[model samples]
Target: MKTKKILIVGTGETADLAYEYFTYDSEYEVCGFCVNRQYIKENQKCGLNITAIEDIEDKYDKEKYHLFVAIASSKLNYDRTKVYNELKNKGWKFASYISSKAFVWHNAQIGENCFILENNTIQPFTKVGNNVTMWSSNHLGHRSVIKDNCFITSHVVISGFCEIGENTFIGVNSTIADNIKIAKDNFIAMSAVVNKNTEENGLYTGNPAKKAGISAKEYFGVL
Candidate 1:
């Protein structure tokens, strides 16, 4: 089989890790990096030229290489979602990077442009939606649904039958009990333990988590 070439659409820390994962673990060879023209300071990155998005197509045709948006979970993953959708609408293809060491059930359904890292246990009948990022060592329980553009950080434990809403960010070491439904655009802060259903845009924290005074949108300055 021919190894696919990939162009990462950021020059940040996430992108650096993505390049390493894709290059070493996956069948994709990262040929270069791309970012908005204003942010281009270096002539090259990781021994490849950093091309501006404005000139990307002319230099590296989309037909030959796919893209991966490697931005972190800033603004509850709004920025990454925007870039992924924008690129898709413009006819640029995307590539998902799932780590080799991750344990995924046979019946699990994962979608496009996902970045799944090592030790993630995506259990039976799980549905992971498009453009989701599951960082290292998360336990996604059976029949759980992770919606599009959500970010699940490392070492989190999401129990069975849970539904994580779109544009949500589950922070590092968080725990969601069984049957919990985290609402859209919400932020579950680091190590928070959520046992009940969350409201849309709610900021949840603490054990048996309660909604904070400020909305998740307000806390992230996304609106």
Candidate 2:
């Protein structure tokens, strides 16, 4: 089989990690890096030439190479989502990667441009939406719905029948009990135990998660 050439779009730590993973584990070849011109401090990243996103199609033929936008969940995921949407509008073919070490149930449905890392177990009937990132060692229970552009960090436990809303960020070690409904634009802190529904654009923390009087924008800063 021919290896798929990939252009990772970003210059941050997440982009570096994506280069490592796709280069070492997956069949995709890391061709180069892409970033907005204003943020291009260096001409290279990960030993590959960095190109402006505006000149992406001109430099790399989209038909021959796939694109993966490796951005962290900044500004409650709006930053990543913006780049993703921009590339999508330009009719770029986005690449999604699921680790071979992950145990995703055959019945589970995962959407496009997602990054499902190692040691993650996604149960049956689970639906993971587009541009979602599930880091290593997480448990996504059966019948759960993780909406678009959400980022779930390491070691989080999301129980069965739970609904995680769009563009939310669930911090490392957080736990969501079964049947809980987490609303849109939420920032759930580390080690939070959410037993009930959450309000939209809220910040939640502690064990038995309660809304911390701060908006997701206030907690995550400007997009």
Candidate 3:
């Protein structure tokens, strides 16, 4: 078996959780951690040296280490996405982290840099695109399509064949009906039940989810 060295970016709760998960798996050897300069209060995390992103490739060779950005918030995820994209452009590879406890179907197609947390049930033929984050216990129904850079919170239920567009954030406990089309940059608030198609950049909420605002950018930062 080939051993892979990994560099986890960030030292927050989510990053620590990821470190624990990957280290116990044995296949991945966590080399160290890397965070933005502003977030690096100390020089180490979990007893391993924590370097800034600017100095990471120097110590761990961009081609030799797999980088995983473990920031949790939606806005931070967006910022991390930009930083990762810049790294990718410089020929550095990024890695995805799928929890061993997650139930992912064999036929599911998950794109690069995705993070699927514990208890996620990704059914057969589901297509999940790059930089997506699916929090714990979410049910991604069969044949569902989740596009790039989306943040799906815990307990969300996406029915079969539903399409979640780019840069959208699906809040906790939300349920999207089967075959529904959620357009780009939308925000579906917590506990909402989406029964119909949504327009691009819309903000939706409530039990059958109606359009609540123009776009999430009006409230949250721009995607």
Candidate 4:
């Protein structure tokens, strides 16, 4: 197989983790790092040159580089998704990272640009959509569906048959009850317990998680 050149589109902790994960195997050859102009602090990152995303092809061929947006957190994840989609439209291939330490079942489906961290347990028949981020040590129950651009923090327990919607964020140590449907753009705060169906764009929290606000956009800005 041909060696694939990859560009990690961040220089943060998550980007470093992704770099280490992708470069470990012979399949990928990491070319460099790319970030928005404002975030560029150093000329080089992790021993690779850091370039602005707009000048990616000026330094490297766009067709020859696979891009991975490595930003964590829901708001930033959504922002990164937008950037990835724009670059994808301009003909860049997106890369996903599935840690070697993660335990993913054979029947599970993971979409493009997803990052499944170490020790994650993705049970059978689970479906994770595009640009989703699953942090370390989360348990994704059997047949659960996590929709596009969702950010799942570490130690989350998503029960079987649960459906998490687009642009939502499941905070750390949260528990979603079996068969629950969390609607689009919702935010489930840390340590909350979700038992019932949530409305679109709702912000839920507490044990048996109740609607805390109308939507996350009020706090995080529009996705």
Best candidate per TM-score, number?
A: 1
Please rank every candidate by lDDT, starting with the best.
1, 2, 4, 3
lDDT of 4 by residue, 28-100 (tens): 6888999988889999987889999878878887777888888777462577778778887888888778987
Model 2 accuracy (lDDT, Cα): 0.93
Kindly report which residue pairs in candidate 2 clash with one another: none
Candidate 4: segments with Cα more than 4 A from true spot: 74-76
Residues 1-223 of candidate 3 have per-residue lDDT tens digits of 3388888887888789878877885367888888878878998888999998888767877768888777765562467578668777878787787888999999999987788889999999999998899989999999999998889999999999999998889989999999999998889999999999999878899998989746677767764
TM-score winner, 1 or 3:
1
Please give the clash total of every predicted structure, in order: 0, 0, 0, 0
Q: List the candidates' TM-scores in order.
A: 0.97, 0.96, 0.93, 0.91
Each model's lDDT comes to 0.94, 0.93, 0.85, 0.86
Q: Write the per-residue lDDT of candidate 1 for residues 3-80, one digit (tens) a residue.
A: 899999999999999989998899998999999899999989999989998898899887999999999899889999
What's the true lDDT of residue 61 in model 2? 87
Flag clash pairs in model 4.
none
Q: How far is candidate 2 from the true structure (C-alpha RMSD, Å)?
A: 1.3
